[model samples]
Target: MYYIAHRLFAAHDRALAAQLAHHLALKVGEHQVFLPFCDTDEEDLVADIKGRRLFELDRERLRSIRALIAILHGPSPDDGVCMEIGYAAALGAPVILLTTDFQDYSSAPAGPRTVFPDPLLDALATRIVRVPRLGAPAQQPGTSRFANFAARNHAQVQNATEACVEAALQLPLPLPTISVPIRDGSTVYAEPSSYTAPNYALPGRTTIAGVTVLGPTRFEAAEPIPAARHDWAAALSSTRIVVDGSGPETPPGAALLIGAACATGRPVAAYLPRSTYTHATGREPNHRNLMVQYGLEATLRSADEVTAWISG
Candidate 1:
């Protein structure tokens, strides 16, 4: 049986610790939770109260424990739970550090911060290689205190779920627009508004130094290349930046483009739309070709929007 030693006892209040342990116990079957009582243990005659000083638990005995769930409460030297968590981490035991605050911790590298019972249980199930199970605790609805607690925890879980779903959705639809480079003294014709076409004219005599210049814009005559570039960069500065995979370095020179947009005061919105690019294309060349063309069209339309925003 897998054990989840309650390294949270020292950090949480007695009531809160008891609540957490009860909830955790419900999630994981046949688990052990250690609660150290220095004064009480000394006064009482409980031989099972294991600790280095209390029951003289050594490294070998501690190694026998399976996992450690560290609860990061406020700074307190009496927090024996934190120390136990550190020891467990040093022993290479699976450690899940729980914290409500975002304060910096020099002792242990931060892990996921979770509050909802479902998420906390899910984390444990993932680490301990246990079967997944999520169920709300049974309670009488007439009680105000229980209802209030459930309402708060339910909202927290819902918010976490929404955030996860949003992140998953953002992975495929990156950028959603691209700027068309228009330089000084360049004749630009706007493209007719179509389902998959940009509003800006294609590249004529101007180019934005390093980036690829897409053709066929249906917008106003082009301005100076540097000025257009700066304007486009300015618009992207505040947009959120999303990357598909940081493992494989971003496409060559792509980093520079993103970096330039981010260097400005605004947040650059960038995502690896390539993931969904292939999805947009089907087995037939007609649809695949159309998708590719539409991507270019969207890029042009984006440029028009940015230019308009910049000019505005």
Candidate 2:
């Protein structure tokens, strides 16, 4: 069985949802599910159906399908799909809706009695014969080198300024205090106080070449400061090492900088936001979930927070 979620939201969120749908489609395809997005036009829909048949899930080739699972995260009205799920139920095809929000649709009468908790599992278990588990697990191929590399670098590939600082500090080399020179004046690593006169150094701070002022930090016109700062981090790499700004969140450009550095086999670190890294070693999963999921432990496995947590 195939299911599609109608994506109706802002551009960025919609794009992310599409990616999520693609991942879901791949999972469903493994079980021979034939889900085509309803939002697609006639041309795309037809092409999708044919593509699924030739490459992965062949709806026409499969004799029977269990059910179509529609994932719903919100309580917005799905007036368009009320009739469709109803039709599926009438045809003896199971219609399941998964929603995080509580919504009562009994009066609306959409489809076959809506199941709770896990509609997809419920439909498959009750409405259709479950696909039997294989006796022996299939041998999966080893992880590719590029994938392993990315996995190790993702935490340090943070798309936020805070992450850039965190990643830099974790580097084996001592991080330089960054400074940015503005058109009218100069700013120290995107920090205002760094530009102050007299010694041009903050109290208890001294500027050292290649160890301070690590930046040509630029900011979006409307934004207050550069999202991230980068220094020529070459000493560690025998080339110009780009230091990402640690004050603000990382901008899109900063992520590319980090990615390029990692690609060259050079050590890359991002200054993760304190909020993001505070729970890196907590017993419960924190913001590091995605980082860990992507195999980015090397980038995130710093001793600073772990030591602090232990001492505290």
Candidate 3:
């Protein structure tokens, strides 16, 4: 399966993204295409999604994906797409960065056809394919932005779309196997104490239900930044499972780590006690968001369940 990550917030972007994804689907198998904007097609920002299920749905779909076809554009490329690329790269999957925008970007030594400014983000690309932007931008407003461009440059759009599909078809699927031993006796790695979780104790336990948990330091430097992303890279590879054992609540970092784990096609499980999640009036809801809910292989509520999940 090929996961298509593109800008999804605006109508202009949405149209272009849909058109490109549609063409890619025609070239590849229809079942292979997964786009996050499917529910947002009518541009209903308010009424469409509930409880952030969209994020969970997309992340879940991204799991076990054969490769990534990420579209980069705008002054600042979509942060979500960049993360998607990084996740796919971590899994050692072939990433084809596709761009059809007319923006004049600098050819940095960092990445091929560099679209984004950050060197770290650019380094994730396995290859780059730039579609020649043929028509000029539409000056008028009211659906003319992407619609006019599409209408004026029909040939350009078709060719570019096919070019992207061809690039994707050349790559192998069911990505290569990689083996890394679990560090220590850990069956799962929990969120580190580096980032503060407002509602719960961070790295809640060293072990759950007799299964050893890895809580290695996420920072390599004196500061709290993920300076040691290498540690996570190794930890993720070493462990068979990555877990969000934050009990009552989840930290942002846990969400990020687990999503990365899912992106690598690793099975993950979590134990978020239901009692702690039900909030009183005026208090923030403590339930697990759908992102974690969807990413987890098992949603365990007790220590007893942890061992059983791990054994599987």
Among these predicted structures, which one has the highest TM-score?
3
**lDDT at 304, model 3:** 58
**Model 2 TM-score relative to the real fold:** 0.24
Q: What is the overall TM-score of model 1 with all chains considered together? A: 0.29
**Of models 1 and 2, which has the larger TM-score?**
1
Better of 2 and 3 by lDDT: 3
Deviation (Å) of 92 in candidate 3: 3.1
Which parts of model 2 are misplaced by more than 4 Å? 7-20, 26-65, 73-75, 102-312
Candidates' TM-scores? 0.29, 0.24, 0.51
lDDT for each residue of candidate 1 in 1-312, tens digit (9 for 90 to 100): 122233323333444435444555454442444433322242343343222134233223344555554443333311234234333433344554443432332211343332321121222211322112222453656778767676655554444333322332233222223232323222221212212232233325233322323322111213222332343333233232211111122221122223232222222222222322212111222211121121121221254453432232
Task: State which candidate, 1 or 2, has the greater lDDT.
Answer: 1
lDDT by residue for model 3 (62-120), tens? 65688888877654555456556656666666778777666643323332333433323
Model 1 residue 266 CA deviation (Å) reads 51
